[model samples]
Target: MAVNPPKIKVLLSANERLQKLKEAFHGKYKESPLFYACAPGRVNLIGEHIDYCGYAVLPMAIEQNILAAVSVNSSQTIQLANTDPKYKDFTVSVNEITIDRENPQWHYYFLCGVKGVQEQLGLSSMTGISCVVDGTIPASSGLSSSSALVCCAGLVTMEANQKTISKVLLAETCAKCERYIGTEGGGMDQSISFLAEEGTAKLIEFNPLRATDVKLPEGAVFVIANSCVEMNKAASSHFNIRVVECRIATKVLAKARGLEWSSLQKLGDLQTALGLSLEKMLDLVEEVLHPEPYSREEICKILGITTEQLSKNILSANTHHNLICRPCVS
Candidate 1:
């Protein structure tokens, strides 16, 4: 989670993308970048969904990554520009680094990372930097592109500020900061991005934030083809709806057994509280919950709470805003 060592001219010549990004930084800011930071996009080989549910996820870092060429500045403003013209440039004062959750722009994701690092280090005055970003990962393709960008930004901020932190802490901070953009991630993307070693995949688990190496079969290749279908998880409700559904389902099950349901969120945590095996959890799901979608009223009634109470208990802010029939205000 520190600055990548300065690449000599020959090494820069060897890596075209790095060379190009360095040139882009010079072109945009008219100054040589001090250093570069990069974090790779990851594709989950298995269990992407269960990561947020307190389960381990298997992901491998892809070559495609978000790269930033950065130079510390005395201007007191963090400026960002992307190699891709479609992503417009952004600038914000170091003291006013705020994330706009309502608008999940590309820059907000980067800001999420910067803000995370700033908060973690408790830096009263952060070092402003001029950054030119380049990314090869396809956005909205389930390749963890946004998370990679956040990780890269966090790493860059740490370096620019001359701060030091462990890779695990950096990963955890990035994962939490992404919530500023209104995505509740389970750390698979950030964890794999930071902890991945070349030639090996990782099984990422949270709570303690540990990674276990998973050796793939020799000569195995994972080819990912994008259909070009695009949906920003932060901008769309489809992703968070599933998260909310899981939260409500966990609470529903907890309430059915007379447990303090509001405190429960993930199904895994609920099962842990009940001390039930996966088999018993399945049986409990069968006995307590239904296959079909439950109406807002039905959900409230099942939890023995009012619509307002249910609304407060069952959702994160971003997920709550997406509810079709938002609980009525009295």
Candidate 2:
């Protein structure tokens, strides 16, 4: 017998908040004034550290998503509420592009989207909005909860303003706004979240900002086991470090070969240009750096390196806990 994978869904129960939201705007306008939009969270299957370097990444939008409830207000102040009452309401002006420090820690991300949209359309002022946001996307799990939230907010705001908003523009606005969160991500999450089709993976090429949808193989199940280790893109400098390291490596390799790094179109091209196998590249890296590469005790003995040095280098590289490889889903 074939085993079934676990299914997850957003479960919103009938409660006081739901009743109040319905009552607040049931017949307020001439037509149905309520607007709803969904934005999905993204999962990166491979190409983790290569996005900023203009490499191809494979990602998919999961079932987890953010659903937004929005209504336009006559005033110039935007008001937002979360399902968790402890999370304070966020209020900001359409004219003022300032960061909210008190309420949601991800407020900067939203502010970025709002400002981006305003700048994109040359809109001097946006109508005030009352929005209630709820989502099933896991926060701080390497899944793109922040991007989904920003995309959902942007969509509602655009709809409320009666403007034509393209998905490409929405993704760009969300990614640009998320920079306020203090992490320099390459816009993969927002792009994938907005454009990804269900049951398909997207291959995104950075710099030029192109996406290709690739269907997943039939009868294949994707198992995403969270190691319970979470890394915050904004709070941690680790992601940036990996980006810089890859750039440095690329530049060094290019200079050694008397060629520009931009000329190399693919990662495999870089390896071929350097005439180095993956193991040989690792060995060269060990030689260039002070300590040797990561190796088990027996492997170190075979390579004639001291175990202590090998262990220390491995720790420095954080190889022990890294998500090294993932199977191709498309």
Candidate 3:
């Protein structure tokens, strides 16, 4: 199996969206675009919130995706524009790519992808790019719109700069780089976005990134329904706090089990250490953690660490140290 995204030579005039995006790029920059890149969003098929624990997650790429028409330029700034007017245009110097985690804007997500590729390729300097982005994925709808945007941007930058990267490497880099926008998540979204193939889902496992294709049962029908609630990851500290709580909880459970708790970050890590089942893990949780929410003081006491260490190692950029939450979601 090829580990790289397939390169398709496009007949632009034939594909409607490509043609439209090309025209839009020409209209905006007064020049024809050089190339286009696309990356799909994903849907978790079975489970989530456990991939970070070194557990495998089942997810599949969706039809909706983020697509961009891009061209290299002598100008030293990267320019970004969206098809939707609600998302404002943005530009940044090629050498000065900063992601504003405080604002959590759409452009910052794209810049996260670009910055990720920049770091991966070790390019201290790169030519500027002008890109027109068009996305069909609904934002904040559990469709991984944000991760897809980042992956699309990463692919676009790599192609425009004439760099080569494997799909797995791209997925891993894109996963870590999404932290620029303050989304503290595992690589499930980015993995499935880049690693998934048509007509099959993938079991994405991290900490050495591997993807295994899984064919669905014959005639199994699944419907994806959005709840109309926007669960924006980067904008919400609660999300990261929940992640931190889980991390801390893993430590507590590990210490109680007479295992090294300090280095472990996910419950999956703890489970793997002792080789326990999900039911056994739950039993351990019931025995170790009380019904009440855990205070930061209590967590520190158990871990034998100071608040500074917790913030430095466990907490995410947007999450606060005053975090007092359950170690596991009830």
Highest TM-score: give the candidate number. 3
Per-residue CA lDDT of candidate 2, range 1-330, in tens? 011111234323544444544444343323333666678888899887566555578999888887666778788887776665554667777777685422337556556666767777778778888776666776778888878877777777667677776676677677777666555566888888777877789898755567787889998898877776766666655664454345434544554457665445334456667777767765654544333332245334433456565344322233333332211111
Q: Could you tell me every candidate's TM-score relative to the true structure?
A: 0.93, 0.68, 0.94
Better of 1 and 2 by lDDT: 1
Tens-digit lDDT track of model 1 for 200-319: 888887778898889999999888889999889999777777777777778778888999887787887987899999889878878877666578778877777887776676666666
lDDT of 1 at 87: 97
Misplaced by over 4 Å in model 2 are: 1-33, 100-104, 250-330
RMSD of 1: 3.9
Q: In candidate 3, what residue range of length 10 has the lowest lDDT sum? A: 321-330
lDDT of model 2 at position 133: 67
Q: Which is the leading candidate under lDDT?
A: 3
Task: State each model's CA lDDT, in order.
Answer: 0.84, 0.62, 0.86
Q: Candidate 3 at 122: error in angstroms?
A: 0.8
Instruction: Evaluate model 2: give its TM-score.
Output: 0.68
- Candidate 3, residue 249: how far the Cα is off, in Å: 0.9
Residue range 171-263, candidate 3, lDDT tens digits: 989999998888878889998988889889998887789989899888877788888889889988876877787888888888888887778
Listed per model in order, the count of residue pairs whose N, CA or C atoms clash below 3 Å is 0, 1, 0
TM for candidate 1 is 0.93
- Model 2, residue 5: distance off in Å is 30
